[model samples]
Target: TDLAAWAHQDVPFDRLVEALNPERSASRHPLFQVMLTVGQSLGSGPELGHLTTEFVVPELRIAKFDLTFGFEEHRTEDGGAAGFDICVEYATDLYDA
Candidate 1:
C-alpha cells in the first residue's frame, strides 16, 4: 500500500476525538487524520536508532508528526576532513498551530 494512504488510515479521527475528548460531541477534525499519518511514519521503530531495533513497537498517541532528512558537515579533532552527518527531526505538533 502507499505510504501516505497507510498513514491516513492508521488511526481514525473519530476514535481520536472520542479518546482525547469525551466531553465534545462535535464531528472529527481533519487535522486529526493528518497528524496520525505523520506520527505513525516518524514514530515507527528500527528506522532510526540501531540499539532499539530489537524492541517491539510502542504506543504513540499523537495528533501529527514532522520528519526532516538532511546532512551536515563535520570535522575531526586534528581538523581533518570528515564525512557528512545525517540528521532527523521527529516531532508531534498540536492541531491548534
Candidate 2:
C-alpha cells in the first residue's frame, strides 16, 4: 500500500481524496468501523461522561471504545479537550463496502 494516500501532512485534501483506494476505503480501516459502532450507540447529544462499547471489524479486530460525550458547548481544561460537540451523520459513496 502506498502510504502517501493516508499521510495527512501538507497534501491537499482533494488530491488525497482522489488517490484513495476503493478496497482500502471499503473495509481496510478498523477505526472507521469502530466509529460507526460508536455513532450507533450515541443517537443524540446533551449527555456527559464516557460511553463504552465493543465491536468486531475486519481483520478480526475487536474494538473497545470509551468515547466522551459532553453537553457543554465549550471544552474546559478539566474536560481534556473541548469544542462544538455535535453528532453529525453523513454518508458518501467513497467506500464500495
The model with the greatest TM-score is: 2
Question: Which lDDT value does model 2 have at 31?
Answer: 34
Instruction: Judge candidate 2 against the unseen true structure and give its global Cα lDDT, from 0 to 1.
Output: 0.41
Clashing residue pairs, candidate 2? Answer: 75-82
> Candidate 1: lDDT over CA atoms?
0.47
TM-score of 1: 0.21
RMSD per candidate (Å) reads: 15.4, 14.3
Report the C-alpha lDDT of model 2 over 1-97, residue by residue, as the tens digit. 4687466577875675567633544434423332332222232554456865444324322223323222325546565445554542222333232
Model 1 segments more than 4 A misplaced: 1-65, 75-81, 93-97
lDDT of 1 by residue, 1-97 (tens): 6887677676787786566665432344434322211221122346565565544545454322354444555566676656665644345452333
Q: Provide TM-scores for the models.
A: 0.21, 0.22
